[model samples]
Target: MIEDLQKYYGYLFEEALLKEIADVAIAKDIKANDIIIDIGSYITSIPLLLSGAIKILREDKEGDDLVLYYIEKGDTCAMTLSCCMGETKSKIKAVAETDVRLLMIPKQKMSEWLSKYKSWQEFILHSYHNRLQEFIDAVDTIAFLNMDQRLLKYLKDKALVNHNDIITVTHQQIANDLHTSRVVISRLLKALEKRHKIELHRNQIKLLEL
Candidate 1:
């Protein structure tokens, strides 16, 4: 796990410098379908992805998951940023997409390390900036994209997670993600399937190549 971290960020840091930060890392196992962190909760820790994937999301008023993004290998789940900023609440829930292993770091400890470790500090700063940008992009997409385009984009993006041409996202989940009605999503999906643009496989969809 440390090797993957080093490989990903080695260009930005000296080997000895990164090793000192990695020394404080600890691993945790999360079962598939488990909630790694709940929405509206408090957190003072962050998790570095070691294996598998995670979904950062929240439920709509109708109680369906809305996927914000996928956190895969070598990524960091930094819910504690808001917590540290005194938000006192999490904006999203994080769930294990598969059985996952993570390196847990306490927020205070990470801050202390960053004060002494320039490379690690820069990595954290960059990650926070990227996350903020992602949120902004999401807001823009929601404001501008139609339901079909939004769903299409999501399927294309999530296809990488499934490791197949097919994607296993439910219509209800799509509705939540797109902030639309399930009936509307169903009608659009059916039309797309008939047009041979996609193949519906129960809850999953296989997007046809253009």
Candidate 2:
């Protein structure tokens, strides 16, 4: 665990801070599609990603989840930071996008380490800024782009995140994440294929332009 922590996060903190984190943090592994945190759940700890990716989602009024962002290796959920410091229930849901390894730090250490380590303070602030920008980008994509454009962007983003141009996903899964119907997603996917933006297989979509 100490070696994993250093491999992922050593560059972000000093030797002393890294040592403290390894000593105090509890490590855990979660399988893909598992819920790490659910809406209204008490957040006792903040997770630092050691490997794989976690998708952060926001629930709509109708109990539908909308994908907000992805936290990859070396990243932490900024919303978790706010919930931890506020001592409140998690408002957003976090799900493992792939099999993931995480380091959970007790919420009480947030302030303690914030004031004690300059690197920790900067890390927290930087996380907040990144999340804020992702929120803005999500809004802009939804408000200004058409459904097809949004679909294309979504595929491109997924490809970039997974580090593969070929994304293995079903149209139904895409619909669920985008909060739409499978039929609609299927139509859009075929249209994209005709446009040469992507190549559709039985259960995979290979990005061509991106």
Candidate 3:
């Protein structure tokens, strides 16, 4: 685990700081679809992803979830940082999108590192900036883009994040992520197929073009 940390975060921090992180961070492995954080839950630690991916989601009052963005290897969840710093509950949810390994730093250690290590401060700030940009992009997509365009973009993103052109997902799952009806998603997917943008099969989509 220390070696993995060094591989991902070595250049970002000094040797001493890296050592401190290795000593204090708790390493854990999680399976796909595991809920890492839930809405309104207190965050006691911040995770540094070592491998695989996590999908950050926002849940509505009606218990619907919308995909916000993905945090993959070498990334951290900025929402976790916000909750830890403010000692507040998390409004967003994080779920493992694939089998994942991560190192968790306790809230106290996270606070201490921010003050003690310049690199740590920079890392946190960078994560916040990236997440904010992603949020802005999502807002623009929802407000300006049509559903077909949005579905295409979503598929492209999922393909890129998973590093596979063939996506294993159901139309209903895509509908849930896009906050639309399964029938609508199915129709749009068929339209995409007619345009030669993708190939659809039972519960899977093979992206043929962007």
Candidate 4:
């Protein structure tokens, strides 16, 4: 767990500060399907992913689940910021997508560390900027891109940089991330496969076969 923290923090911070930060962090291991946060529950801490995956989701008024995004290792859930700001209600639920480990940071200590540590401040600022850019991209995709275009772009983006192919995401997971129907994703995958552009394995999708 500490190794993951070092790997994540080392990108924007020094080892010393990460050691200090880890001092106050409570390492926790959670099982798959665990609900980290409920729709209306108050969260007193923020958890940094150390291993495995999580997802941010919400149930609409009609009780249909909408998945906002997947949180892989090193991703922090956005609900923490809302809770820190004293929001009365949670806009999303955070659930562990796999057996996961996290480094839990209490809000009060995190606030103190942010104020005192220059490295922490820089890390937060950089993270916020990247997150904002992602938000902008998601909004643009939803507003302007067609479903096929969105799916293609997402696959290309997630594909290995060198290969621009060979993505391994599942259809249901992609549907959740894209806010679309799984049946639609299945149809799209079939079309792509028929065109010899991709192939579907048991749990993985391989792209750019041609």
Judged by whole-model lDDT over C-alpha atoms, candidate 1 comes out at 0.74
Say which prediction, candidate 2 or candidate 3, comes out ahead on lDDT: 3
| TM-score for all models, in order of appearance | 0.82, 0.97, 0.98, 0.76
Candidate 3: list runs displaced more than 4 Å: none
Candidate 1, residues 1-210: lDDT per residue as tens digits?
567667655677677755754777676899977998897787767787767888788677766767777777666755556575564878788988778888776677676767777877887787787777767767776779887777777777667665567877788877776667889999999988888889998988998962
- Point out the higher-scoring one by TM-score: 1 or 4: 1
- Cα deviation of 80 in candidate 4 (Å)? 1.4
Off by over 4 Å in 4: 1-4, 14-16, 32-34, 97-99, 154-177
lDDT of 4 by residue, 135-175 (tens): 67766877898887787767765553224466656788788
lDDT of 3: 0.92
lDDT of 2 by residue, 1-210 (tens): 778877888889998999889889999999989999999998999999988888899898998888888889898999999998888899999998888989999988889999999999999999999999998998998899999999999998888777889998999889988889999999999999999999999899999987
Error of 4 at 110 (Å): 2.1
Query: How much lDDT does each candidate structure score?
Result: 0.74, 0.91, 0.92, 0.72
Best by lDDT: 3
Candidate 4: give its CA RMSD in angstroms: 3.7
